[model samples]
Target: MGKKFFEESELIINADGSIFHLHIKPEQLAHKIILVGDPGRVSLVASHFNEIESEVESREFRSITGRYNNKRITVTSTGIGCDNIDIVMNEIDALANIDFNSRQEKENFTELEIVRIGTCGGLQPHTPIGTYICSEKSIGFDGLLNFYAGRNAVCDLKLERALLNHLGWSGNMCAPAPYAINSDKELADRISGNDMIKGITVACGGFFGPQGRQLRLPLADPNQNEKIESFRYDGMCITNFEMESSALAGLARLMGHKATTVCMVIANRYAKEANTGYKNKIDDLITKVLDRI
Candidate 1:
């Protein structure tokens, strides 16, 4: 590592040449990365590795790289939300494609294969608790992609327009404008193994307010859950709700990387059921995803 070229305000890197937030170097990361929302889950995924190589941690982000069945894989925790995804994705891409010493992009870019394995609430009554499903498309209510350029080209404009029209969306609504994007089909297919249910996933900005979970505060749209449950476009129904998949899929597509999400249905909102003992299910999902990826 040499003297820093990027400004501290623009791009922050540690003295050891690791990225600021992730505390990871380019060589430590693998091309195939597994992203989870919980820092504790990092080791859970790495537990399947045949041999451990490296481990790094910074704040809520934790990373481990090792060989899984002779295949190199990196597992990292992103904490939560598209907000966190913004930071993690950019920094990871920088670690892979940016020359830290020169503060510029490398001549040859690396396209990462990103897979998000997490837990979500099933919106549909049919998708029961403890079910594992892969997202075919993700609808984002977080508005992360709106801040970036060239979003229209990466988003599914037709689906967005259809959803807007169907929902009677107005500027007055408290919800942010929604954008839809499809997951990388190749990755979804591989992860699903034709055994999991594939449906649209909605990524909300907040767990309570945006997800229509009313506790102490009232929602602007009280019928948000009902609306989402009834929403269908191109024969696809909204299946589940989570916090990060939309931005993961959207930003990955914009960056020319392959991304997909496989989540365990821990709660069924319509069925009024929740699985308190979902650790075994999650472990099984982790094994399945690790085997595929």
Candidate 2:
């Protein structure tokens, strides 16, 4: 056989049939996807997959595609933040779209459903830690896609302007913050009763200093997290705080795909979530969500 083009190869796969970062090929991926930020969590996710099929590991991205409820789904790691999410999300889409021989888009594309099974600090205290919460809405405090659309279009113009005014926010940066996007209904229904808490709010952090966190230095806004929780628009409170949900939601909607997230509350702004070591507890949550998802 002669040399193959990019589409002929999984870019992520080797001619020797070794997997790339995820180290798995087309057969390893399922129509449904589950994403986590940590590589270690990938094993936790894969442990739940039924009818063990295949596995791959590259860099921080660990992936396993197998059967769950007889449904084929791929579980992988996104590393961290929107940049990583953007990369993994696109690659997964490409795997299903392109011919794996030529890099060209397929004549008929498949819109794979994705669910981010990660951990986050929830703004709503009622959202207890260890609970698997789904993100019906996502708001980026990180400002990733701030320039993509009109500021007044998605959310309340009055609130945005009001917050700006109250903060005395004058701008060299007047770009619009990303808006909320709901997850896939079909997928959501499938996993609805599966140890999952639906309707979570995801917060994207601008950085350490601003997300109500101070390490060696002082913080810019001590009450920022509270402000996020305090604001209730249309009874939809910011459910949880993370770095990628809003961007994922918005981008998924724009791409004509359905995306949703179920996150474990690593920390709750309010003193409600059972006080336990963050790491191990989050592990339990991830397992629960994946089994149900």
- The estimated TM-scores of all candidates read 0.96, 0.78
lDDT of 1 at 233: 90
**For residues 233-266, could you state the per-residue lDDT of candidate 2 as single tens digits?**
5656667777777667656665556687777777
Clashes of each: 0, 16
lDDT of 1 by residue, 172-231 (tens): 465479889999999999999977999999999989988889999988879878888998
The lDDT for every candidate, in the order shown, is 0.91, 0.66
For model 1, the stretches where C-alpha displacement exceeds 4 angstroms are 1-6
The candidate maximizing TM-score is 1
lDDT of 2 at 190: 63
C-alpha lDDT of residue 269 in model 2:
67
